[model samples]
Target: MKKTVTALIGLSLLVSCGNKNQAPLFADVALADEKQTSDWLAYGRTHNERRYSPATDINTNNVADLKVDWFIELPNDVGLVSTPLVVNGVMYFTGTMNIIRAVDATNGSLIWEYDPKVVEEVKGKRKIGWAHSRGISFYEGRIFAATWDGRLIAIDAGTGAEIWSVRTYDMERSLYITGAPKAFKGKVLIGNGGTENGPTRGWVTAYEADTGEEAWKFYIVPGNPADGFENAAMEMAAETWTGDWWKHGGGGNAWHGFTYDAELDMLYIGTGNGSPWNQKIRSPGGGDNLFLSCIVALNPDTGEYVWHYQTTPGDTWDYTSNMDIILADLNIEGEERKAILHAPKNGFFYVIDRKTGKLISAEPYVETTWASHIDMKTGRPVEVEGSRYEDGPADITPSPWGAHNWQAMSYNPQTGLVYIPTHHLSTNFSDEGIDLENWQAREFTGGLGVRRKFSDKQPREYSASLQAWDPVKQEVAWYLPQETFWNAGTLTTAGNLVFQGRSDGKFLAYEASTGEILWEFDAGLGISAPPITYTINGRQYISLLVGFGGGFAGLGADAAELGWSYGIHSRRLISFSLEGSAEMAALPPPYFPEPLNDPNFTINDEMAARGAIVYTSCGVCHGSGLIAGGMAPDLRASALVLNKEAFSSIVRDGILAGRGMPGQPEITERELEDLRHYVRQRAMETSTSDRTGSTNNPRKEVESH
Candidate 1:
């Protein structure tokens, strides 16, 4: 077996050496579809989005012998969540700031690098370039990256020279690319993120692979009817909308998780949540917004819509279908059905007939509070009223984190099961108008109100689980739950093993049939990317991107509730193989800046309550509760907060917006005074505790979720 693999690799290298252009590196979609183990060609390994590997060299029996082969440290502090692609012994993925890196798959050695140079203009207290790019794609002798700065760039695969580039979105708008770029047939496809932060609309565009020319673009939501419809689909979708949705940008961004079916010649796009999240605000008449929270099928030749199945019609909870989608042929009711499997944010696992857009089965995979079930006949969810926060505040389980996020799930053909990274967290939803001043307080969650101040009433501590699901039976085969939430995506191979990383800093593999953990490595940092297996010179290896920060960073207060240390010191690309020994560099401990002592301040409970509300927006940049989760400074220890006059100047006036502190236009003199009182009190308490060697506040300890 070793000799055969070596000879095949040698022959391929000789063929490549005969003619050394980018032609030898081209990844044909059809050829990649049948591939199981030799190489990882596409994002999902195969165009079907199975995320399954056929490598058996590192089986469950010998997986314990696997050691770190090599590691590459990334340069940016932003999270690294890209599922890397390897072809012909070459590895490629995107780091923070959408910087692309090409590495030798066998050893962790950098070959070439390309920085998108995402311009970072500070918007008040926030910098612009912190967003991430999930991964990149190889096609037509070129490498493609959908950058956070809203550009689709193609680079020479062999060399790191820029081939051609095109701006995909308006710089003025918040839309940027974070999902992996995909290439199929003769075109490359990319999507954007940012609808959650602004009145953004979502659209997916396809470009000519050879040239950076726009081939076709598909808008998720209908635009102004006056502008005329882009196609018949828009005309049909417009009828389901009742208000001036176009003004709100009617989101439905195909932000992440797209799959392609070569056999059906169909492109499956999972649309995102609505812009204003609250449907009543965006569309007062309350019609089922077409395309939003839906898995729509489109024709790859043209950007024409074929069929769609909406998961959450009138979506008000950010229940996006933008989670990963897997295609499989399952036997059900005595027949083999071609189906698309989806476990979206809505907390339901759906099996739809991919050809005609019919719902074969839709069942809740988690403890879903908003909907009881989906009616098979109508294919609509039986929503629980008040779940939309129509009458009052309603608590929804599985929160906006969904039962799952963009973390890629894997479907193993051998085990006939899918492994998913799932979370158990809930949020209290309220339908109330946020004060215009505080509108910016929360990252554009459609001006919706959510409170995670669990304080006694919130559910038990949030948790994460690796669930092995039986897709055909629509049931969970086994589950391994953890105390920590926000675990990484899964990768399953023919070796009866499943691999995933944890937010609490561990990379693990579990027995495929049972839930017993087979092996684990203390990564010492969070990972959001899925694991992938590939071979170079007859050696099968595993690799995944690691770093901890992304959407959850901007999710207000308790956003850090899920095990992130807030320390953003390291980003690494880790690879492992049987008995391979490589040492990873040590990680710096979490930042604990010294607190400024304030001997003159008095604690005021009322002032603290008022200040708490004011601090919500600040927590987006600084960690939760002014306790540094490692992104920014621990305000409780800042000298800026120690001085009352300086605090007032920076807080009340736009004095340091360029320095990333947007002044509070919503706070009056009295409110400013109250905020000063609160920060002073917290700072004093922290300083005293540090000096006296007392334990941290229980509330703050729990913030690490």
Candidate 2:
């Protein structure tokens, strides 16, 4: 139900190999040459997106002494996924809304801030896609970033000032930039989004490192079959899809984080789901959708598809293959070999041979009922009948929220364990292909589907979990479940300690081997960001962005139906070390007040204006017209306006009873009236009186009059 936008951002690094399909404009800078000592430069450490660090200074013995040094709260709810990059004694990281800040790593103090001017409308609008900057890439003292609105920017890392900027994609067409711009071999490799929103074509392009010029673009999904990039690959890929799928635009996008294996010189990219999501609309007969939902090995220089293994072929369940593929060499089948480890949204942990892209062994790390098992024979999934949405509501466990979402995972080579922050949730999806003739022009252009609750909703009932998976054993070695929905990512040290924070405002260090609680502290708000460990002035410091919101809870995507609380929100950055003293004592989580039911509420002008601003909170899922993924009711529709009281009740108490849509705290009647009036005005301005067309059509702008 969410529209796709290119959110690929990059981080600091240099490339060892070049892709063939890449254009000529991207740079080919060499990373790790001169400046390779003790710095956390890029996202996931290297371009391979393996969030693992090689430093062993703070080993398991001293890790228990970790304590809070200092922290600061940001003003936005966008998930703080940034990893701090420390060079010398200063720390460079991103604040909310592409806000880059430099802080003194010795003491959590602000050094400087870089604010890339984002469009005002894109900042405040409901559908403006949570204007966020994940993290930045550093090269030659310059920091590079892909903006929230589709621009590749370079700022002086030392001064936090802009050096150069370029609009990489057409923002007018809704192409947004959320990826951390990766610098490798003089070229900036980046992937685009919009396939989820129904765009027929999506690609990963590289820009010249020094010049920000378009270098190359490798289309993840071929263009329209008939008039698309008419080639053998396109024609072959077309066969994998069904229906008049050209109109739907095959939507396998590379929207999540990706990785690169310098040893192999192959760039690995994880693809997304088909555009309409309904298999019948894609390729009805069903074949391997080539690169869609697959990890494709591409020539970093040419942008050519080398080899791919589709995670979810004929993807009808929105099981995007957009997981971070960590590169590692492990002893598997009694042989130590190079392998790419993937824990995709499909609920499986896959360890594939890196050299050949062949599956070594796969295992289910969660409660999965989709595929019976990964056939060792063909390396394909033997999907169960109930897994596909061919029939009505298929009861798929680990609903596309996934056993693992975008939360980054850390691979500790020492433990040979992948530390993942994962969730267990499910959704019931009823696939209804877009009636192209009846589609509307508004932004909410995805198909219709309802999310349901998975039986194991218990984990989320109290908290999510941090799991340590042993790929060799294909089993969970240890897990520490939290009473929070989201968790900051894991950071492991030579000390045999793993560091992670809970959404309930607690940051703790656990024994990596035993999963035993070793140390803990409260960071004020939930920590949804990944933590980084770096030494400043010979002192090792640990940092994490402490924020509540973003992801399932903040967006309220399928929150209620999925039994997630809606609006327990805040954003901040917290850093720690052994030198600081632990101040606060451990306390029980606060008791949340029951949802209020204030039916007497009504709206006034001033309150309406303020309410309009608050609506940004709802915009992550719902578009500007209050028309989102249909997960949230469209206020402009007849169903909402015709029953204002019912709308108010639903807002206040929630309609999906099991889904945690509790009403807000007591708002004055005047505030309620203002909210009602503002929504009513918005509805009148964008209502569709006659339902004669499909909402997926991009041409029909909604006008109430």
Candidate 3:
């Protein structure tokens, strides 16, 4: 039987205080201690962001005995991608619309629940973003979380009551928060993602943990000189940029990969790509855009720039350095040096000196065609001629989806290897028809200066693998090919094991050093979140959030074919232990939505053409080319599109906003009709003969990742 509480309850036992004799829960020293393995205090377990545990009770030898200990069903949640933070045996995680839940780590029992009510707060104005949060943070007695509507909130850990809340961005702008709030010292930090949706000048803010007061803010890109530089760092950054780059909101949003070095007393931020993604349009003079796609070290207290190492200088291929920044001590050239292990979207695995932001070694972990290699002396990628689509359309390896996206990679200090969830994909980038000189960014719409070419005739090749890379040797030690792309993040343990969940709903444990699968479990749902391990009562437990719906899963139609259609399977937070005997309920069989046919209704081709432009907003959740990728309901298969009133009530009336569907009050009635017609056209084109439709209808071409 399941044990759950719907209402928030005050539980004194959940706090770290025991008889008023113990140190406070999540103190600065406690969060920084790498030796503590009983609880996961931070996103990366520790400030180092290695995602490795020293606990060894569940070693590779006995990993096969692992079974489900407990699980909590999340029926209302969509994407279960947030990492659960364990504090003194109480697990806290953020779900859809930033709902925070506290559950018993020993047994899956709810302690308290906190809802931020993001939809009601946004008032249906914002339509995009708001899929899932990467995680939450813990400092002292507070749990910190960032909402989809760009608000950072703190809740009392004992009672789940809101302590303080602050908006991180302007409501009018196209900014949203999906990354976890990094808490360190007495402050919590957050950043927003909207580089493609608007003219966003990406930035990160640090706020006082106890109070909602802003402490320090760092803009990833330099703003206009007419407004004056914020500091000398912005002035120094301006020298490397040409043209009115600030007008495009020079995008270097640090959406993920934030690490704080307790030993070095410094902060490392993995910055993002240009606003429009086309440097030719954002930075016409072709100067290396300062801090875009870079590992920038800064003073955590002051938010002051220290040093940076640009991975993709003059980046135009959406190669953001927003991947995980793992801090470790490496013996390079027979000398001990602090290093940052990073595998970004560009397909290159970087090992840089964390102290000075200097490149130690860099190598291609995947098939990299944009750059031949990273220059050892200059630490810059050697770009191949025409790779940037300078002459025309060019097929590039390691597409914008990245060789390694925001998925967390774990580093095992015991094995001297970094376990990375790697993938291989390519995109054909072109600016063929866009007016280069007169291009302008549209509000809340994709501002990518370059267009990704899509064709039904072209065959797309893609694959994923779990790779064990040696930072010291700059090579892959072992690799296991996955069945599909966009696999979940990895977790490594000193127990000589690596745990990762797949999009196919299978969770596996492997020998950390040998790439041998020792155990597997069918989760019955796609998992996009990383698994975390912690111990309570001397029993080590492995836990994972099992649900799929992230960037790639939402956009790629092939991913939707895995049978994890929207709302078909239950989202869950599942845990396992060697002593676990609890059985998991079997999920419904894999479901593939059949396109609904409307014999009575006629599709307006003219309206469909206009609706295609408007579909861009809907495509943020619904798939591109009208194919739903399991994130939202596949409109082609929904009967609601057959009626104009039903479609408008859900799309423009905000009636279903409570169910993760945001209303677009801005969409006019004509646009709504056009959208309905467009979806019907796609349904007719993709419907099969047996489904009361034409057999000759060709499949819609989708954008290659």
Candidate 4:
């Protein structure tokens, strides 16, 4: 097998030798085939989502010497969430604003940039509808990426120009792409992520690599007509769902991560939570919603459903199985078998046999109070009824973000350990008394719910934790606690190091073997993107984009509700390495508004209580009057009323495009006035404590380029 692989690599290198422009040396691991050199050829390395690299030049001992090599500043203040792909001495990545760039890996010089310009129809709505392009895919000299607003584009890897483009879905319906596309076997598979407050079904589609033609699509949730699949599989799927799930678009959105196992000829995809979130709405009858919230294994060539293991049956706690499904071989009951491993949002590390979807073992990787334990015999989660949010203000652990959120978690094959960046924090999640449809528009109504802060409720001993799990033993080996939260993904190196960016703005590297701190750099802002490593010339460089923004970065609905400084004016793409490196380039000035203290308004405790009642009407979408969800701004620290014009326009006209803040006619003028007053008071309270003095605004700070 090794000889065959070596021969293939050699043949590939010979073919590339004729190309004069190609770099003489590519990836750190020189194979017989040079075509595979230097570049991250597939998503998660080779589509199995292993995220493992053969490059060992920067391993354990030398990793400590890793320092700043060369850094390039993007001209725009676009959000940078892309996990860069390095191939043939060039780095390819995307930004939050949906621009793709190809840079010379050796010196951080711009090779080319492709701007998708996912511009909104208007500024306000743009802020609201803006979608992020996390990363892109490469196949046969072309790069593929799904746009924030529903377009699948293929670009020339060398030139960074659009080679062919196809619309993935309709943007008007609120479908967008925030995840990277996976290219395998001459086909491009992509998923749509926008299931926000809007009504949309999640689906995975494959297109012909060369022609840009969609070949086949598998809806994560069953469709209204249900025409595509074989009658047997479709019939089996239909049996699991009750009611007109077609109306609710059958809620399961597989927007996050997926992996393909070539050995098995199967593709494993993580399915998200059902729509309307409230189980009462999705499956009123309550049976295992077969495909929703599960790891589905399918045939890549035919899009045939092979088998599925439901992760969360009738998933009620907003627990979606749509976490990254990594494939690995593990021992179960003394027998080694190929298995699929996952650290789902429900806070459990699940191991299932890949040959046949059967549970091998399951255990909690983080502190979760939601379920008593996973019934290994039945592979079902035994939930404590009181732990669930049935309706009318219930405290649900893990919140909607899950115990381990969507930041990428890396599994190191060398150490046989899975490193996860997790949040030990918990929140009280409630289902506003309203039903599904009404919940969509008037979702934030305050009277519908309340939340008790659990962080302070627990002793200082309890907080966020980063854990390393031994999948073979089905147990946690070690854990490191953070003062706050670690929402970023984990990146493991062969050097026995694990790198992760924290919510508090520290980019840390820990000893992968013992969970001890090796080194940490203050990126000066919270990180939302994953860290990646590659060899440019002879040096191994580590790079990560740091900026404070994203749903986890305290973003609220509408620009006005978010704090400006935290908006990440310098969310620049930064690359670094060791000694005598390229001189650091000067950064552009930071953009911050002068701090201003608004005149205090005397609203007694009684008035605050009265305003709280009024807030019930506005909270329908803003989230229990606190503005918690990323879809909308947090009202507790809102600055809407700080600027009267901005406040009134949103209240009266509504900034539907940007913040998802809708204007309600049912709100009486008196109620609006009271709501405005309540917001002003909240702003004042936030200002006094924030110390930055700048009003919380969620939009990006324009760079003075």
TM agreement with the true structure for every prediction: 0.85, 0.77, 0.96, 0.80
User: Model 4 over residues 22-57: C-alpha lDDT tens digits?
Assistant: 332321122112123255655565555656555666
Q: What is the lDDT, from 0 to 100, of the residue 461 in candidate 1? A: 46
State the C-alpha lDDT per candidate: 0.73, 0.61, 0.84, 0.62
Q: Candidate 4, 86: how far from true, in Å? A: 0.3
Off by over 4 Å in 2: 1-37, 73-78, 121-127, 194-200, 228-232, 432-444, 448-463, 555-570, 581-705
Candidate 4 Cα misplacement greater than 4 A, ranges: 1-37, 120-130, 224-231, 332-334, 389-394, 429-432, 435-462, 555-564, 567-569, 583-681, 689-705
Taking the tens digit of each residue's C-alpha lDDT, what string does model 3 give over 150-266? 889988887787899998888888878899999987888899898888888888899999898999999888999999999998999999998999888999998998988888888
Candidate 3 lDDT for residue 703: 41
lDDT over C-alpha atoms for residue 589 of model 3? 83
Which candidate, 3 or 4, would have the higher TM-score against the true structure?
3
Residues forming the 10-long window of minimal summed lDDT in candidate 1: 1-10
Please state the error at residue 234 of candidate 4 in Å: 3.3
lDDT of 3 at 561: 67
Clash number for candidate 3: 0
- Better model by lDDT, 3 or 4? 3
Highest lDDT among the candidates is held by which one? 3
Residue-pair clashes per prediction, in order, are: 6, 82, 0, 38
Candidate achieving higher lDDT, 2 or 3: 3
Candidate number of the best TM-score: 3
